[model samples]
Target: MTDEPRLSAQDMIERLGPVLSRRTRIRAVTALLAGVAGAVFVGTLWWSEPGPLPGRTHLAFALFTMFCLTWAGYGGWLVTRRVALFATDRVIAAWIGLAASLATTAVIIVVAVQRGTSVGLALVVGGLFVAVALVLAVRAHARRAALLRRMHELSGREER
Candidate 1:
């Protein structure tokens, strides 16, 4: 056996606990709050409409509301399970979030253009969403790189 001492299971757990818990809590709360707020806003609009709406509009609202609820459910699961999300998992999740943001932005822009109303506002909001998503993606990638570098350093030390 190598002379280097290893961390005990408890020590490893203690080391990881703070890092994982903070990330998990932040992600869970963000997801839950965004999802619930989106759902409520969309639902309110759909319910309080002044006149009859097209079937497609109804369908769109339902789908968007469902999408928000899905995120909320995911957040709830994360909170309840407190699963350990690794750096790679975070990278993947960030990419998924970026894609979702892009698609949603595209849809919003299309709808605004078709309606000929608030097109500029839609574009502005969409840009913000895409920007946030891009930032998250970049941060995730940087984090993963850092973790990989740390892993390599530890392995190199162990080999010596």
Candidate 2:
């Protein structure tokens, strides 16, 4: 007979809840910090520029904070499930990077067109975000290859 004790589904879930919650505390705190930092960064930038355009920046920051919180929640869920995170995380990171790049780029373009300004710091920052997104794409591709190799090994299949 196996030495393990049998547990009902409900019992298993109930027991796991506290354990998962403990495991997720660090992730939750990190996400919260990131969200606050992002908001503060945006707010500071807006404060420096005394103009009506700051409203748009505030809106953008709000969107960013919402995205960060949602991403954090997803990460916590992943931890709670005790899933291997590397493969899944890369795709999510790439998606987030792409979204940030696109959103920032759009904001820069719209602001430039509307305000007839050039060489602003936001434009430079947006360019940097694009570069970061490119890096994320490359990293995600590498992680995917690694994941496939691991799966092949686990399945006792020879890799081509």
* Poorly placed runs, candidate 1 (over 4 Å): 1-19, 33-52, 80-84, 88-93, 117-121
Question: TM-scores across all candidates?
Answer: 0.64, 0.58
Go through the candidates in order and give the C-alpha RMSD of each one to the true structure.
4.3, 7.2
Tens-place lDDT per residue, model 2, 1-160, is 9998665434444565453455455654565567556656655665676657666777676667666665566555545555434356556657776886878688777877779777467777888888888888888889888976765564453222
TM-score of 1: 0.64
Q: lDDT of each structure?
A: 0.74, 0.65
Give candidate 2 misplaced runs (Cα > 4 Å).
1-29, 36-58, 119-124, 157-160
Clashing pairs in 2: none
Cα lDDT tens digits, model 1, 30-71, are 887888999999999999988999865886788788778877
Q: Could you say which candidate leads in lDDT?
A: 1
Q: What is the lDDT of residue 22 in candidate 2?
A: 52
Model 1: per-residue Cα lDDT at residue 19:
40
Candidate 1, residue 73: Cα displacement in angstroms equals: 3.5
Clashing pairs in 1: none
